[model samples]
Target: MQFLQFFLCITVLLLYCNVSRSAFLCELNQANPFKVALTSTVDIAGKGNFTTIQSAVDSIPSGNTKWIRIQIFAGVYREKVTITYDKTCIFLDGAGSRETFIEWDGHERTNTSATFTSYAENLVVKGIGFKNTYNLGPKQNDLVPALAAEILGDKAAFYNCSFFGVQDTLWDVGGRHYFYQCYIQGGADFIFGKGQSFYEQSVLYYSLETYGQGTYIGYITAQGRDSADDPSGFVFKDCVILGKGKAYLGRAWKAFSRVIIANSKLSDIVVPVGWDAWQFVGHEDQLTYAEEDNSGPGADTSKRVPWQKKLSEGVKGNGHVKFKCPTFLKFKVKAMAVTLSDDEVSDNESDKTGLGFVKSIFVPETHSPNFVPSSKPPVSEIVKQAEVTPPRKIRVDL
Candidate 1:
């Protein structure tokens, strides 16, 4: 009887484990389901399939095999959006960064503060702006950080997108991500996290409001690589660092944090001491902060931290870093430039009103010989639709 009871208990335990695992997988599937083919396209703007970006994202089935394309119209969507882990191969396209924006007002310690957060693999977001309205300045009781976008998935790429906030603007958390021709703005520890990421042809802008503040001194990055064996590092290539006030290139968030800025241009906003120890004085020697072939006034390394390294010639080739898996290349494509012409302008007087008059006055012929303007609204019209507001002040405890 004793032996039989023990056997029954073991069986029940195994069954419970299996059931829990299945339930977790089911939850993931519910968040992201498997689909048949890439025959459907979801449009946002009360026109096509969905009205909101999150609704369109939720509509996608789990373990999606083919690409799920979501086209967002020109407008400001005041909401937080998330792409869960199971939703793979998603292509989120927007009208333009200035034309289409996603905004929220969440600060650090807030449950849902990030304007956009992605935990899905093989995701591509282009031509959109993500912003957090939580400003970090003297008006606040304490320094409260806000994240515009938090990317936490592998093989994720953002092109021509803009991220705006005052602190922790772009959280490069846990991913092999690539950002091309994107603009990221923040004040302190703006580009941070444990991700192995590559930023190419992107702009990193710092805000002047947080300059000279106590602990909020402008620092662009705070990479958190725990050890030398970790394959996570941030590589900035052919990028530009610009904005107001003095700032450091980066600070070691972890002992083995690694960062590289190669073939980039830095404005005078950067401080002479390019890197910081970040309370880890002795451990600063273990960090791998390096720069090569960088130009502009801030590229001078004469006063950089003594522990900072100047990358060797052989290591500058980017041959040692394994960014992402081989299949990740399937999501890469040449960025397209959209141009408008006079011939494509509408003859209707009402359609040719407002900013259209300004566009009509300056029509350039250098665009494409085959380029024919369509009746669709011009890019400037979409940009004009965006409403700009002054930053808001919030109270918080230190």
Candidate 2:
């Protein structure tokens, strides 16, 4: 018993010394140092690199060029997390959106209250859920801006993630961003910002919790495009909008607010007027809220706002709509498609897409020559309506 206690004490001392020296914890776990150098596991139980996500991030040097993966284990982290602008090329891999959660309940100014704020460019966050619990927390407060996550970086992508809040849920402030298979749950202008973003196969869930009983009114997006050619807008492709309460698709937060819901599913929760001019009331014509190829009970366009720009179904064969593809900074990547399942796609169909095999297509933010324009011309101008091939589901890439 004495020997065992001595050995345990020595082991603890060694771990402390190495950690204080900034040495890799892989020494104790018997893992390869090379792999440990690239991957920093953030386990709150203290079995990995650091006990907190912020510590794991702080370990990385500023202006990092190589990719560093921060493996966040399953846990409920109730802390505010921020990634500064200089800390780039970070890959935040969580256990799963349902398993790993970063939650906080700050009701302060929206600028200082986001649960997760990432200003680092070239960042990829996967399988994580960020929640701002201001309303859900002890206070069950009034309707105000409680941001879950704010992205102010370029080339940031999120996959299989989720955001939870009320009012201003996700502030996509600037730059080019992509959200894939993510869930955004909120009410009011939950998704408001000026970033050029593409939301693919995501779900926008509106919750009328903060509003008084039967007040069920909300606005999903408040895009802030300020000019005729701001090049920044919100595009939802192959997404689903289903939730409680009635809400407008968006309201012009600025002079030329722009938003598009294309090839998506909308529940009856969507208001018939669809969009609101808001502060830009008389200038509704300048608001660029558009919809195309959408299905579901709420997709009727007859009662839609007059300013809603209606798009056309141009591309054939893909279970998708052709977008005005975008160009990202650093990498002039064209929104392209990759293959999903062999049985799902046919060889002839594959050949027609020009890629022997492919799946989804990257949604556009602005313009790329590879994809058809936002709105295609008449049937006679492109192809006869009868000749157009049916659509199929495919995977997309940037």
Candidate 3:
């Protein structure tokens, strides 16, 4: 059956290979420098001559430029767009995430045959808003909307950007990516797809406007596919999670998945168990889920399940500055720990957590034998709650 499926995939690739002027697939690994800007309000701004995004893309050379800067003016764009590989090494700078908005509502499952597109390499998305509203509703929705922005090439970065939606918001369907000082709000698996990505100092908001208690909120990172050699997972650090429903910090979308969270403020919205096993699909025990120094209303660990990790001082380094964790989970825990210290707090401020404002990590001096993985169900049941009737057909818009 696997071989048959592979054959079918190859057949489809060949059939669609010559349908349109294929976007140049330059080696995304190469570093290029190019600069462009979007400062128009025309129907096809950068389309023909510095008017439309499509036009600017159509004019880019068929390779990764050294550096490309596309400065954009503040505006609300109501068009569905795609940036091809030819526009590699492109930098998009808008007024700000809140000031600039690019919105569309099209679901592949609902609008079957809509071929979702992608961006090129070194695509820096700074100060812009990308949103899709397919699943933004008041009930258990079945619509998996098309991505707000899809990055298919490598080394993509988004600084101070906002991705708004209720389902998959930022689809990292390609290479290494990073998001810094960004805001992503949704209810389900907001940040989904396959990529070696890192999200730092970002705010993840869970919306109850769609599915009240039944809604799935909070996902710092969720990994599904196992890429060949690259770090095929997600790392979230120094992030703030806020919502009003029971939501796991994250879960293994597929077996062998990995996710790390540290030094972040957690609201009571986070589930006690924290991580889900996704029904123990294939490699159940191989998934990596861990957390470090975190404080807030949701940082209480006494009632938390044993599977979740506690911050430790043993991993300290550089005179209490460094912690022995990877990427996203690395500095946030320690940073938050230091920042929450009572000694550092002013005498006028009250300790809200009641755990004191000092860095009192839950590190065990000795390995506790009672520490065991709990059997509680994961907090996120968005997919399970969705009774997708009469399975909708996928739309492949090319």
Candidate with best TM-score: 2
Better of 2 and 3 by TM-score: 2
Query: How close is every model to the real structure, measured as TM-score?
Result: 0.69, 0.73, 0.64
Between candidates 2 and 3, the lDDT winner = 2
Give the candidates in order of TM-score, highest first.
Answer: 2, 1, 3
Candidate 2 per-residue C-alpha lDDT over 1-398 given as tens digits, one digit per residue, 9 for 90 to 100: 00001111111121112122110111111143322237889888889888889888888898666557798999998888999977776778888777888998877898988999998866778788898988753465776788999999866878777888877999999876888767787888999998878887777777766465247678899998776535567888877787767888988888978777877888888889999999877877666677777898889989987767644232423655565333321124354221112112122322222111111123232211111112223212211221232111111111
C-alpha positional error of residue 369 in candidate 3 after TM-score superposition, expressed in Å = 53
How much does candidate 3 score in TM-score?
A: 0.64
lDDT of 1 by residue, 1-398 (tens): 00001111111121112122111111112223322133234344577677778988888887764556677888888888999988876777787777788988787563356889998866777678888876743555344677889888766777677888777888898856777667777888889998877787667777746545433458999998775445466878777787667789998888777777877778787899899888778876567777777888999988887777654333334533212221122322222111111222111333321111110001122110111112343222222222121222100000
What digit string (tens of lDDT, one per residue) describes model 3 on residues 5-122?
1111111121112132222221222222221222222232443235455455555567644344555666766666677766665656566676666776777652221122455754
User: What is the lDDT of every predicted structure here?
Assistant: 0.61, 0.66, 0.50
lDDT of 1 at 13: 22
Q: Per-candidate RMSD vs. true structure?
A: 18.3, 17.2, 16.8
